[model samples]
Target: MKPRDLFVLVGIIGIVLMMVVPIPTVMLDVLLVINISLALMILLVAMNTTDALQFSIFPSMLLITTLFRLALNVSTTRNILSKGEAGHVVETFGSFVAGDNLVVGFVVFLILVIVQFIVITKGSERVAEVAARFTLDAMPGKQMSIDADLNAGMINEQQARERRKKIENEADFYGAMDGASKFVKGDAIAGIVILIINLIGGLIIGMLFLNKSAAESAALFSKLTIGDGLVSQIPALLISTAAGLIVTRATSEGNLASDITGQILAYPKLLYVVAATVFVLGTFTPIGPTATYPLAIVLVISARRMQTNLSRKQAEEEQMEEEQQIEEVRSPESVISLLQIDPIEFEFGYGLIPLADTQQGGDLLDRIILIRRQCALELGIVVPVIRIRDNIQLKPNEYVIKIKGNTVAGGELLLNHYLAMSPGFDDDSVTGIETTEPAFGLPALWIDEATKERAELASYTVVDPPSVVATHLTEIIKKHSYELLGRQETKALVDNVRESYPALVDELIPSILSIGDIQKVLAKLLREKISVRDMVTILETLADYGTYTKDPDILTEYVRQALSRQITLQYSDRGDSLKVITVGPSLEKKIAEAVQQTEQGSYLALDPSSSQIIYHRLNEQVSKAIQTGQQPVILTSPTIRMYLRQLLERTMQDIPVLSYSELEPSVEIQSMGVVNL
Candidate 1:
């Protein structure tokens, strides 16, 4: 239950209890007892007492009726040696013995208050914790949500699969770590009991020095006053404060935050200080009882102000940090704007001017002697000219770039046909990725989501000589850098992306979990090209190194195909098995030349599952076997999954359409040591 509602319920119960019970002469005493009990319950909850039994009315009832009654009985009987009332003090106790319940009731009420407070706050901190958590999530304090509207079609197979993997991993961690900050123990009742014991014991001790007035002195022994003889026991008060502090901290350790100043918050020393300050100031200064009491109340309540200020400061800093990150995403092109520059006229020489001698002719060129470095991409980049503005150019290629409003126009003239590249921009100068900040936009290169992500990844790597992995990789694959790479280079590129970057490895894991689903997505979007065997390698890599959020079913289908492919290749290539012939491109031809770099004689991106094969050039016999329903593994230029599916579908109609199930499972791994994904 919420704290306020719980308080209201307790209040109503207190009223009913007071009215229901018949207390003619002892009504005031009974009311006070009920009030104490109500306060105890709230104290237990706010202090976060976790024990159900203690919180229930059973403990409260026992304390009020038993402990409170006994304490009150002893407390009301005083040693009245003061004002010559020694004789009167004796008469008061004697009257109490004559069965007068009014005096008896007063003593009971005080006892109940002390006992219940002790029981409730003894060792539980749940009350404090609930209050803290609910308070943090208070209204108008939550961060704005950015629920991205995902486009299934626009994402393509690679992105959706990767994003899902990362999200699922974070969700699992959050569910487990949610309880890390909760308090373990906070017992306010124990501190109260210690105080009560000290109270009762101190009176007994004081009775030795003072005669009939000892009882009065004990009741207010540690209490502050405005005159002499107020506290004859300084040592006793110090001990009581120290004991209360130690006990409170021990009990509240679990629920209370370490950041809280224990000495200031729950430490009993603070209460002692306030009481002492009041007594000393009241006695020395001209302060009245009324003013002194009010000051004490103010000091106690204002203790929490410092903590509030600290929390506010931390929140503000975090918000500022978030805004700074959004602002940092601004693009360089927009930051360096040129007033008037038309790219088209310069590239084609439309606004022609004959050059004196050979002044590079309208194009800026740089002959950069490349440095040998180990990283990723090593492409020639366009460097912008300072102050002169207009016309940004790259090395060797005389190109012109122009920006008029949103349109980006650029053309690099080649020996043959003119090459063209155009991408647009917006007011924020942000290229085109959706961000948490609506105030900022991205640059042109980042306009495409995939490219933007790749650019971020590139910042961490040193792209000098770049990895030789992709130098000759364009010819085999069909996308951006595909035309420039060969088969070997293609495999090398995949290996590097999968293994070198921890983030990339983590991102690929979820996609690999459901191998068949991912393959299908790849096939549909990427032109139907990859084989089941290749998909298996991707899946196995994910299982071994990536974080998989789904069940093992993701592994079954793909593992089967990979194993089947392994068996087929292994059996055909074995020495004793019937002669094997690899039709069309040989294994050497299929593997890219760039990837042939010696890594202990194994293929750079070779799936450990590779088997021996007797390669033969494509011949008429291979075509006849394919037509006659004899299955043979053929190696060729890499094609997208969708295109491969179409080619295989046509082949199935002509042949018997043998299932890949024939391959053996053991051939998948081949005992080669596992490599990092």
Candidate 2:
């Protein structure tokens, strides 16, 4: 063990021994002096600590010191009653400090006890109790604030953990102080009891056993008892004062002495006023100028010096700040830093600032965090951190969402108005500006609050401005999610899968296919609005069919066929048959025959007139399915699904094209319409 730990163990053992074994007066005096020194050191350290938590061990120290003093008292009581002499240190206190008068010595001891037990210890205990209560009560709020800062990227995880640890330490320290104060109070009472017992026992022993007169017994015993009490109580008073200082200390950057000096001298005018008052009191009042005039002159000089120092400090701070700014401008890193870009950016004009400002009760940042988690759950991809800022180049009520430094979607919002969309019928009765919904292009209107209740009564869906922006951002992210899944994200997904399906991951990655190939397959799924959350099946299917073909499109078709159940459940309602649009036998045959294949890829080798005829027929079938309240799904053969999707991608952006193999066997399919040429 280290020397300090060994010393502490030995000291505790010695304290227990002092109560049982009698010691010589010389050794007692040494121990007595050490006790006084320890108390003084504790007081000085407590005074210099910047915060109570800095002296976290002080509560345990208080208990040890209090026990040490009591042990010393027990040893001295034994020596005085048995030998009529305790130690030279106690004798000196009784004679020199109390002027050799027993009554005076007893009175001084009483004063020390009252000051420590009544004023300092009692007050410290109350303050500690309240502090502990308040700290525990505020812990949850402090923890939440730390979490908010972490989410907002103000502090890293390590910094947040450190701050939370400090808060916990503060609470524990205050609670310990609360219990430790009682030790001081009990020590004071023990001192008083020990003194009385020594006096009575000393008198009885001296008169009855030693054949001494009553007066001599009383005199000798009184002096020793008073002296011993004084020695113990003085240190007790110092320790109690230290406890008060510790419990009452507020958090500050500097020590107690410096904090007091800096704050009090901050305003020189206050000192000037005090000096003037003192000067007037010395000149006009009955009090003479002998003492007051000199003190007033000293205060005036001190104030002038303080004012000069304050001015110099302010000038130095301003100069330092200016120099720092100039250095930052000349630094090469400042210009090079401009190349960094946020992966996602949300920019708004000045008028819509309140929608993104947390101070104004806006929850846009919080909503953005939820959006990221939602995407992770639904799309199986991690969205990048979005940087929100105000751009003066845009119009005052407009906002834009950018993905990888390019604008993908933009919209306008009215702060005091709500956007309302009709369920189905036209509502010309509502008075507002007609606009299209930014997320889906559905017809919508921006109406005032007065029309909100009326619009709801009219069966219109109403949404606030922030929600509108959030919804638009969500849709944009969902549509362009394929562009966001790079190789890094694909690696993360593989690592996650490795945790559960280690064998499957090991066989597929870097063996049959690389991370780049996996990313392409995942991106293809996302482009078709398919979720890659079912990674086990996708990886398993890829492992089975990956060696047959190196193309991502072909690999994705195999994965989709393996995930037929999930795809079927996604589009069909519960307990309802699947309604789909199909191509006629003649048109399907024509398209199947038009497919041309090469080593690079396959392409449509159909005539332009036949392509036009196919596009027009598909549009007519899609329109008929939508008019019948059916989702526009085109079911085709597996051989032509990719080619047909590529053919209709630009013309039918909202329609989902599926192959017959992509459907589950349990789901019943009903053909709603067919495209014939």
lDDT top scorer: 2
User: Which candidate should be chosen as best, given TM-score against the real structure?
Assistant: 2
Which window of 10 residues has the lowest lDDT sum in candidate 1? 224-233
Tens digits of lDDT, candidate 1, 466-514: 1111221111121222112333443443445566565644456445434
- The pairs that clash in candidate 2 are none
Give candidate 2's whole-model lDDT.
Answer: 0.90
- Model 1 lDDT at residue 645: 24
Cα error, candidate 1, residue 108 (Å): 11
